[model samples]
Target: MKKNNSFTIRKLTLLIPGIVVAILTLQSCQEDETTELTRDEEIAITENATFSEDVSDEDIEIANSAEIEAGIQEPASRESSSEKCYATTWDAATRILTIDFGEGCVGPYGRQRRGKIIVSYGEEGNYYVADRTITFDNYFVNGNQITGELYVEKAVINEEGFYENNYTVNYTILFNGGTTFTLNGSRKREWIAGVLDDNFANNVFRITGSLTGISTRGISWSHQIVEPIIADFNCRSEGNFLYTQGIKEISYSNSRRKRTRTVDYGDGICDRSYTIAINNDLITITAE
Candidate 1:
């Protein structure tokens, strides 16, 4: 009986270590799964954010040109290489400016676009100070359908005497692959340079904003611009429209876990290189 009791105790002691090892392994896997952000996820978040900026840039350009052409503002240089496939019509009585892209056209950044952008204003003034509501009509950019409204608030001059325009955004992007991401955010554009020269290409803006969205992959994410993004339209980089420099932090959560990543767009360089840091791993991706 003594021998049997000793044997039972030994057996129990041997099983305890195995149980602990199993538990530790399981926990390690869970931590890895929850804390590590895959490259695909990082790309998705960045691209979605980029899409918003790209659209906003186009909106501003079109509205600015329309105001100039409609005799509302002084004509600025319209030097652009984008194929002209759109017709602009302004109704003074209705205070509406319509940009119709018949069929399809390759835009400034080499994106194919088809549809109309309807800009309705409160009064005949520059797009900067006037209350405006921008909506899209059957708009397809780069084969991806975009639906949204950008409400441009009245601009205010800062101490630097530059116009600062704010926009409230609510947009949904349906990718060509049938996936989708719905984004809601606000963006503030500060005309930092070239306001006096009136050259559209030389215009520089400092953009700050935040966005929240949920993707079709069931990932909920939010983006906060930690550093003011410098967008130099003249410093055109390969495969990138604007946003020449800045830093942003993206927080995302999925069913398994939550994680955060930082995106650095380089030190004000004119290149398509950005770095994503997640879980202590840094990856550089070139925009294409």
Candidate 2:
């Protein structure tokens, strides 16, 4: 999708002031020798949230398509093939939509997936104006099992004529090695662009709010989006999808003490590099 001119301008304006502050902040701090949360734990927490966001959006897209196909709404754009790797069924009586990725199928980013995503809509039975609850049935993505449900309240159009909703996620990922990652929180999502398109690659969303979870290694953490995050579906890093741009404040706590950090996803670049600031310590990560 072409860049939205107004949004692009606003984002660039933010970079001007942010760059100066970042430089000053970095120059003033000396790197710390140790961190409360291990590098792996930090990465796992972020990755788990990214995975949940991707899956939640995918479920919404599929349900939107099902609504169009069922004549409940007009087509947004051409039907997307992202979910074509699976079988989808709609039960009008129950207001439930199911997308089944039998045995296994390759999904976005070439991740192997299986099982079913069952979505139920509210009385309106509409994708745009009704609430949606999505649950998984023995779902596994790339050998990691996903459990729990994602609840999305009905959309409310903002003054700018864009749809906004509150998304509550109670999710867990159990890795093949038996380690687990879990997230339980709510975030506000705004459809900033591409609402008329069925293809997700053209979509862009802005997210705000906080999430608290346990990383794969059992570290307790809380993350708050200090700067609204831009999840650009058009951008992916090394086959692992992530929020293209944003700033978030993350806090790690255990029995002894708490450590707070700031993470920046960068200036809307589609690269793997991101910066983390923990007190006097500065770390740059380029996902491998």
Candidate 3:
């Protein structure tokens, strides 16, 4: 009888441990499910968020100003003279418009030295109405050769006869030091009134976008504009052209370290300087 009782005691001890393990396994699964659900909810929220709702008007204006200052909207022109030297050729067979930058040509802002742009459209009748893809070959920017492509999707012409193009840009820029950087982003471009004409001095434009880039030095940076950057050529007379307001995020060492900062263009004034704020620390940056 004592031996029988002893055997029963041993069996209960083993069963208790098994029960504890089973309970732990069940709890772990429930925790995993909860974590997965939370991740999914966060992703859903991000997917539903829109720039117009999340970004402020001031930031948008600043971003537009910066874009204009960056000369992104400026078409390719001759390096020597005011005469536009780029040739635009349309191919009916492929529904493509090729803009060739002849030798010694420069980009709109004089940022790019030489490159050709090929624009592909879905419909041939109206280039602005259809979805278009623009590819660049040997595009030079800031003495760096850039290659890759960008596309304009979901573009619409507003009732005021202005073109609103949503652009998705991806490009790889190879610097003179053989370092490469990849930039990808989505931006919106709108034409300012009276700037589309021959008055280059009076040209004003707006651009807003989020751009992310990865550098060959293992650094990654991202900029999210809170307001459209406004660019006014009139501001050039004041010695400032690019106005930028945005949030910049930087990560390095495989994201082991990270930093977030707010960038503010000079207070509604055209200046070649901006401020960056990280927490309570502020740094002012000026163009050289």
Which residue pairs overlap in candidate 2's backbone? Answer: none
- Misplaced by over 4 Å in model 2 are 1-36, 62-72, 81-83, 236-240, 279-281, 286-288
Candidate with more favorable, higher TM-score: 2 or 3: 2
Candidate 2 has its poorest 10 consecutive residues by lDDT at 27-36
Give TM-scores for every candidate, taking all chains together and pairing residue i with residue i: 0.82, 0.78, 0.59
Worst 10 residues of 3 by lDDT: 47-56
Full-model lDDT, candidate 1: 0.76
The better candidate by lDDT, 1 or 3, is 1
Report clash pairs, candidate 1: none
Q: Say what the RMSD of model 1 is.
A: 4.6
Among all candidates shown, the one with the greatest TM-score: 1
lDDT of 2 at 37: 60
Q: What is residue 181's positional error in candidate 1, in angstroms?
A: 1.5
Q: Give the count of colliding residue pairs in each prediction.
A: 0, 0, 18
Q: What TM-score, to 2 decimals, does candidate 2 have?
A: 0.78
Candidate closest to the true structure, highest lDDT: 1
